[model samples]
Target: MQSFDPKLDRRRFLIAGAAAAVAVPAIAQDGLIDEPAAGTDPDVVHNISSFRARDWRPHFSSLSGGAILVDTGSRALHFWSSDSSTYRLYPTSVPVSEELTRRGRTEVVRKVVGPSWAPTPSMKKRNPEWPDFVPPGPNNPLGTHALYLGWQYYRIHGTHDTRKIGRPSSNGCIGLYNEHIAQLYELVSPGCQVLLI
Candidate 1:
């Protein structure tokens, strides 16, 4: 008959627990684990892999008027010039929570350099301490340039906080590094078609 050894059972349990503890954080770091971003709602689970290059053809029928595809899941923005002569992929910061996320077709209705910023009603309500308006400058949330989308309060803009890129950190807009956005601003125009997926 086999003997029950408490010490052996305890040792086995400890080793298994330790292995799981180590593995879980690594998986989360790689974005393979389903978890909410820090300071976000627990219900907002983000399960996204690292950025992978994508073909614009699958997302848009044509690059007419230029095309911008923001893959929220991958936190990457893909841009194609009208003539297909220019293709650029940029890391971006997406909505912090799913509720704030907006998907589907839109277009750049306006292009602004050194754009001013105002907190949306919801944003102001959520963050009462935020300023009512911020003029274009170093502290501006819109960074050096802005592409105002057809959807109100949503923009493909640059951010002063570079750490927000490639993470779920924005309220709803897609944010890029100031330098990258500046480059994109030159490539795109007011009529550029945008798809957030």
Candidate 2:
């Protein structure tokens, strides 16, 4: 895991699927999703070596595509592909979880894509080179895509800083690689169920 970098505060990270509220300037490039992208690791995405076991409704429960569970404390994301492909990539400093439970399980929420990466004033204050908006790319810093967790800005996504793939990095954004984010992109959406066990 990568140590936390103040530049990319997870709290200010963008909320995906919603547009027109805040459009940061950007230099457009080919918005293409390459296969290799799905394979490369992203800085914002955390990883786990093994998974336990669980049972639940499929992620395709109508409007509920299931959920992605994340255990930030565990430094891993469990892809419960069975019950909505749960993802468990925990953020470092998540406040006391206020979420309720069902059948002794955490409630799953919607999945997201290309989650926005809105920088903090401190980020700009520290790094003047930081741009208001960074388009999606290997250097964009927000990685490629983010899996927004529940209501908070917390998420799991690709990273601008991937050197810390297996280490803790960012204010809270889980880091993977550009290619990895793209790969996850092909399988998930904003409504997929997730459990942060």
Candidate 3:
């Protein structure tokens, strides 16, 4: 029998622990641990990878069905179904100002397909290089659709840049990937209740 070496044992233990930590999240991301709902679109399944681990799973919510809930802190959105137990999760971008993400109840005042973008007065002041108007198209910052909020100036819109999801990169609007927004737009309609928290 060989004598025990404390240093070698500690090194092996650390190596094993580090490997386990990395593997757990990887497995979760691959949809192995958190199986998606049956018949979930492949694109939606792919989009879930962008969400943080804590925000990836579905849970019971007290909010009524047919409601949209935005969790700014987690950079995630949940569209609750009529049953309340089911929801579609999507990652979103956060606003630069915390105040812009005020918590309250609101409704979708309007819905537009291929929305035009006109930088607000404050936005123009902050970025002089920004164009006064951007026509609705691939280049438009609003992407494919927009759900205008009753709170004014705020929206849940799509973005041409997919990488912006799950980041703090928007002025005040919640940004979802173009494909994700297209799917969301079909599910939402004018006057739908929206809760920002």
Winning candidate number (TM-score)? 1
Q: Please, what is the whole-model Cα lDDT of each candidate in the order they appear?
A: 0.90, 0.48, 0.78
Per-residue lDDT tens digits for candidate 1, residues 1-197, read 99999999999999999999999877777865455558965533444555555667778898899999998988889899999988888899999999999999999999999999999999999999999999999999999999999999999999999999989999999999999999999999888999999
| Model 2 TM-score on a 0 to 1 scale | 0.47
lDDT of 3 by residue, 1-197 (tens): 99899999999999999999989977766764354557864333333455433331243344443678787877988786555555687889888778556677888888899999999898999899999999999889999999999987889999998878888888889999988889988888676778877
1 versus 3: better lDDT goes to: 1
Candidate 3 pairs with clashing backbones? none
Clashes of each: 0, 46, 0
lDDT of 3 at 163: 77
By TM-score, the better pick of 1 and 3 is 1
Alpha-carbon deviation at 122 in model 2, angstroms? 6.2
In model 1, the runs with Cα more than 4 Å from the true position are 1-49
Please give the lDDT score for candidate 1: 0.90
Q: Write the per-residue lDDT of candidate 2 for residues 1-197, one digit (tens) a residue.
A: 98786656543454432343444222112222222236644322321332222223332243255445444555444444434434433222221223321111233244445555667675577678877876655556666676665545456577756565655555545556667666665666655555544
Error of 3 at 115 (Å): 0.5
Candidate 3, which segments miss by more than 4 Å at Cα? 1-26, 29-65, 83-86
lDDT of residue 193 for candidate 2 = 57
What's the lDDT for candidate 3?
0.78
